[model samples]
Target chain A: GAGVSQTPSNKVTEKGKYVELRCDPISGHTALYWYRQSLGQGPEFLIYFQGTGAADDSGLPNDRFFAVRPEGSVSTLKIQRTERGDSAVYLCASSLELAGGGNTQYFGPGTRLTVL
Target chain B: AQSVSQHNHHVILSEAASLELGCNYSYGGTVNLFWYVQYPGQHLQLLLKYFSGDPLVKGIKGFEAEFIKSKFSFNLRKPSVQWSDTAEYFCAVSGYSGAGSYQLTFGKGTKLSVIP
Candidate 1:
């Protein structure tokens, strides 16, 4: 893809429901990241991937939030037993270079999740 | 934990007025700094970045930012503001330790509304 693409731009789920968000990164990019943004706030880091392995998952708030980039091109963020407090926009980004260096991270349109 | 701080939560200015948004970060080692902008109904986009070059780095839309290591600041500026410049700006930083340890820490964005 020419740019990062996210699926189901808006999602409304009931509390305790499980939801999955997907991201398709640009071709040949080696780094992928996930972030969460609450209203009137900046995006908060959730996870990062270099190739197929998750380089960092320290940002995941708890055991309920998980992400995977198995193919190194597409990634999925899964929230198990979602809570109303989890209502926010989930953003995905990708960079051409791997982690540990300075590189531009291109952002996606983001998935707005509304936990009702 | 590393963190970024944006001083102004909101700023309003008339067209052609000078604009500045303050950003500061706290980290113990070398860091990479960046500024990103998000317009209404649009995704986040890069404004400028400061890795290891000149203290002042120019970016798209006639915006520039100065990285002051002593103060741990990466303040963004524009000589004159335009209505098109109305957007939310964010400051982000990443630690430059080693591979798989890179992640961005972002500040709460500053909402800039430039009236024409």
Candidate 2:
């Protein structure tokens, strides 16, 4: 039983560069979510996908942040022109069905992105 | 403008001590509550959750949470804690928007340190 997993456990990039973080959800999970965690803070919602379409993207801070889950099982969070403030741990989670009150989300060991 | 609050920022206790972590959320309508634990280098794991039915919900590893609708709180408790329970605890809430999509809003986690 493989849990949700993220690629590049740690990534260091320049302030003005672009970065793409990938996530592989647990087998059979139909819903995926992206979140960001800053130092001393809890995770903040970024985006959510149900199947192949994004059900909610309101949590995304700005247009510079975009995510896609074309295949419904894997997702990628792309950041354009990264900033120092964007340095944080990017987390991914997935559930067996569309996220509601009862479904439990399984998280991945987040990918820590450091902008220098 | 939904928000979750964790009253304690850090808690240190000895093994076998009773543990309780406070969580309160502010939202206008029906909500789903969850408690997640993150060990030193591991991913976030679901400790417990409360949806509709019983106010008292039990989760894995002897953890439990009680949801009080009137108080807008979902507090996590464990009668006796072990050193292994030391980790960061997060409280999250998701409002039922009726659109079939719910995004989690998490609190500024509480770091628990259990000494053996």
Candidates in order, TM-scores: namely: 0.96, 0.96
Chain A TM-score for model 1, please?
A: 0.96
Q: Which stretches of candidate 1 lie over 4 Å from their true place?
A: A98-100, B97-99
lDDT of candidate 1 over A1-116, digit per residue (tens): 48999998999999999999999998898889999999988899899898999988888999999999888889999999999999999999998884447788999999999999
Clash pairs for candidate 2: none
Tens digit of per-residue lDDT, candidate 1, span B13-46: 9999999999999998888999999999999999
Residue A105 local lDDT, model 2? 85
Worst lDDT 10-window in candidate 1 chain B: B96-105
Query: Per-prediction count of colliding residue pairs?
Result: 0, 0
RMSD of each: 1.4, 1.4
Query: How many pairs in model 2 have backbone atoms within 3 A of each other, for residues 3 or more apart or on separate chains, i.e. clashes?
Result: 0
Tens digits of lDDT, candidate 2, A28-113: 98888899999999999888888999888888999999999988889999999999999999999998774456678899999999
Global lDDT of each model?
0.91, 0.91
